[model samples]
Target chain A: MNPAYGPNPWQQTSWDARAACNFVFGGVGAGLIVFAVLFGAGGLALKGLVLAGLALVGLGLFCVWTEIGRPLRALHVFINPRSSWMTREALSATLLFPAGLAAAAAVPGFAWVAAGLALAFVYCQGRMLQAAKGIPAWREPLVVPLIVVTAVAEGGGVFFVAAPLGGGGTPPLDALLGAMLLLRVLLWFAYRRRLAGTVAPPARVALDAAGRLLQLAGTLAPLVLIALVASGAASGAAAAALMAIAGLAAALGGAYVKYALVTRAGFNQGFMLARLPVRGSR
Target chain B: MTRWAMVADLRRCVGCQTCTAACRHANATPPGVQWRRVLDMEFGEYPDVHRAFVPVGCQHCDDPPCMDVCPTTATKKRSDGIVTIDYDLCIGCAYCAVACPYQARYKTQKALFAYGEPIASEAKRHDDARLAVATKCTFCVDRVDAGIEKGLQPGVDPEATPACVNSCLANALTFGDRDDPHSNVFRLLAENQHFRMHEELGTGPGFYYVWDKAAG
Candidate 1:
């Protein structure tokens, strides 16, 4: 490896904690909006969840704005749809907020519209990271699916956590959460293996640690909790409490993984020289 | 129809770093920000050991990732193939910095001088407009444009050539329009075995390193 400005095993510092927060809040918020509508939230419950989701998404965007050096010129972010994923993301947000408010107001089929737009918002976020061709971990083909799936899993997790406000988590929603948790863990392993040779050693180590947390706290614990709720093994307040704990685990664990993905594992693509020149070999 | 390019004859280079210093001086780059980096490399082992100084910077690629990923359209490519960043339009989001595979883009938020405060020379040349924005080597576009306005040839004229190429003591660096068959860069390229860095990424880099003189 070369020294300082050279071909060192470079870790990208351009997008740090600020960028990570965008993924954390934006993914979960978008997920929350979709899952709440899908699970049939109604009246005040529907309004509350949709508005809360929109607020989280807005806060995430605000954090990103704070990170920008020239925040005043930020509207220029919408200028490049022909080539930029970031531009697409900004454009998607323009439609998402109105749909979310309409759904919150219990407009006939606007809930579904809100759900669909939220899905697009989250999908744009995934593609945004994957478009960074220089960062090996982000550029992997599996990054898009992993981001989308994890966000869905987080959405389900939050639904269970906020169940009391809406009637409660149904058996079907519990099963869906279990399935998403399983899928997330499996996808993570596949993604990790695919990037075995590409990432720097430190990045690999950090990802491995996150993977362990993802499987244990995010996947296994939640799976067991959801099983208890589904099988009538837990009831009444016991069931709600258990399911809520599992949701917290799922939400927090997935957030940690995304944080790690954006901050810890974003090593830049260093150069690879196939041949070295000899000094005086004329 | 012109594509400007730089050719480096690796065998003739002695790793003196004159080009590096000349480039920094000419551009007035901030501390810890080097647009041109000469990576010292050692290859092989023991008795058969070989060494070379590999130079890297913005490739001025045909399909630059920096331009494609720039949310503000601040990064643009000229018809002549030189990639440039419009300081006025940039929002300093640093998206282009991460998109660049060469690690060529930099974003400095403040005016930092080399010796604590601005020296006499630094005070006169520092560009405050470059602060809080993405920056990289432009292949000295200003000099090229000015030289052209004066009806002077870029690659052939000492004043119009990039400072690094003009300051190279080993005569390893050459700059010219690659499309011009009569240019020195094209002649050197036609007579030597050369390769562009990270060519597999399909960047179509304008910088070429001539490795073997006999292969052509």
Candidate 2:
């Protein structure tokens, strides 16, 4: 049971690691679709990235299925698309998976369409978090942008690693990764600043610390690696090593952010007594 | 359109918690799961200390965040303003519990008795469907509905009224229709100064607290 003084008497967060994985994988998966479409890296590189992304999105939904009290009735999640964002997310995934397969098969027309659906899926994921009005941190208007930006950053990171592995390398991707990292860090700061006043003190502190950590490891480290590659300070195997490390750090950071937000800082709005109870005479 | 509401007169409440006990008995809720509770609030400095007993439960708002966020559409609001959870449909995601700012919702994953033993009373009243699902005060919807079908007014008839309202020894709790001009809740609201919890959030809560007589 939650303490009386804490934000909301219900201390248990509704969304746990399972739910966070749904967002992380879904976001990254969508980002990969965009990467595949933009780079036009067919053969193993495109197929592998798209397949991995689809697997991740599938895994995320599976994680949510495991979290529900009634696993048997999980299909009911699709029934309320008229209002529920969860349904919309599910609907988007249905389109994303088939489109991703087509893109992987080198269907030119399907690539852009898949990329579009992936973007919508990522946006829907952000909206899902924002719609949870009970949790002050989640409902912040900036959460939507933060989520979308983080997903893109993570997708960029994945492409950086996957491209080199598939013998397809591009100089522009390093710059793009740097830009995404900068945007993600900026969004983190803005989102944290927005939450400083409204969120519970403990939750605010936790988020602040987490956001800072994300900046250092997720954003700055990747940028440094990208800089090393550009400066010719690290070439051939060394540059590949740096890119891999940077990509891993960036992707992990995005996943960690989602985990912390869903489980740690996800405090409820707590109980509000309309009027202070009068003393003595009353 | 009868909108059901509860009015708690702060001046009259003695904070005996009889309402809590009655609610517990009526619902047969598992241990630690309280549908209704009385909060003992103390205010002012030591010398000027004053105590107030506040009975808190589900407000059953017109714009319920719980219903809106429910992925399974398990939570629903009645035409008469009662909010209910379809236990069978609920996945116990606790989304509704987190969405309710009033702390009105509760989720119990297991069945437990008051003591270590599963008593006869627990077995008789225990609902298997309620396990791992969000539960809260329905304003005694079963009683209200049954009474209405029998041509009895909910707020006026003791049998039709909520257990908490009927059990309040101080007569502090009042239940009636907010939309009805002749209803006790409407009359009380018209005659007294009242406040609704988190009214600024625009939830349009059904519960009202009559704080002062002079302010009305």
Candidate 3:
């Protein structure tokens, strides 16, 4: 009963900005590998994008590594696959790195293998938050789809931004970006509505700002840009530049929302008193 | 086949915090951490108000979320139903901290002292292994184990009972085996109307709050 942290649901201090960075980086990274394979990039462009995806995931894992209290015992994170989503994530990473390298090397049939592992990695990341029953904002069943869909949208955004830089020129990623972004926006609103009663008041306030940004820049503006590109308002470098801008908008939207979700909205389930005890003859 | 549990009679509690002091004195929990603390709550509006003191801590649930989310398997539930932590095996991920609905888990990276500096009492209990790992109430597991080894019953023996229960000035708190039909906890539950916190969450909490039997 610390007077400061008391009886109501309080924001959890267990995770900070670093934990948010993991999802931001890892989500885009995992999404990139899948999109690259699905879109069919070859030669140096394939290698470049795949390597970039693997690097981002590695960076995300490194961020978590720095936050551990006992870094020496980190290998123990792989010990509990029977129950822990985190252990499944680590195991997926072990497979993802090797498969990503082979795909980047243009090995036949490896791209699909790498993409599958990457998708599983992203899935594990989503489950990580859902597993925390104490945080009402996270334990919502909708969080899984929301996170997974956002990553795919962000990945499609990164694919458009990076694929054309090496002249590997994307094949109509604008439609894919629009599709994922729309889905994400819908899921975001649905998730917010679902958490209306469960989350603390402060958490709801934090989610509101992120929700606005996601709806505007992540979904609406990107759809407008895709239309302009299709109507041939600009072509060549100008068109490529517009697509990259749209992609960055989508990617950053998901990341900022995730950051807000982890840092600002992570509230612990406070004490709940169902009824007061009756006094004698009162 | 014993499931250790505790019950708090809300009518009898006075919000004195004597149990809190005893728990800290027994466990030497670092500053800002209370393994056992009573919640002082007020209900109703002006001209008609009532205050209630509800003791809160680790519920030690039958299905612990902390245990399921732990990647290291460092948190485990014993046969006696007390959840324990393996400090050395824990990587200090704080995953369990977020998983606990009762907010019972505590994790700190640095060794803390009660005074500005380490005093004689603080220096004697400087534990390095506990740092950077989750720690919480074990329902005084060590005392219960030792007492049991000496052929002493936990509910009946003052030495085996939790420090908080032993120090309760109002005699509001009781601890005993839940499965034992002849135990104090079983008798109390049979005689009184009680409720567990957040029962809707399906935590199956070991702690119970006794209100009244007449109302039921």
- TM-scores of the models, in the given order? 0.96, 0.93, 0.96
CA displacement after TM-score superposition, residue B23 of candidate 1 (Å): 1.6
Q: Per-residue CA lDDT of candidate 1, range A81-121, in tens?
A: 99998888788777889999988877889999988888888
- Fraction of true contacts retained by every candidate, in order, equals 0.71, 0.47, 0.83
Model 1 clashing residue pairs (backbone): none
Q: Which of candidates 2 and 3 reaches a greater DockQ?
A: 3
lDDT by residue for model 2 over A1-282, one digit each (tens)? Answer: 211221233344566888878888888878877876776677778888888888878988888777777777777777677777777888999899999999889887887888889888988888888877778888888999888888878887787777668874567887877888898889888888888767777787668777877988998888888998989898877787788788878988887888788888887666555565342334
DockQ (model 3, Cα): 0.66
The whole-model C-alpha lDDT of candidate 3 against the native structure comes to: 0.87
Give the per-residue Cα lDDT of candidate 1 at B192.
78
The runs of at least 3 residues in candidate 3 whose Cα sits more than 4 Å from the true structure, single-residue gaps closed, are A1-6, A168-171, B214-216
Index of the highest-TM-score prediction: 3
Q: Which candidate number has the best lDDT? A: 3
The DockQ values of the predictions, listed in order, are 0.62, 0.50, 0.66
Between candidates 2 and 3, the one scoring higher on lDDT is 3
lDDT at position A117, candidate 1: 85
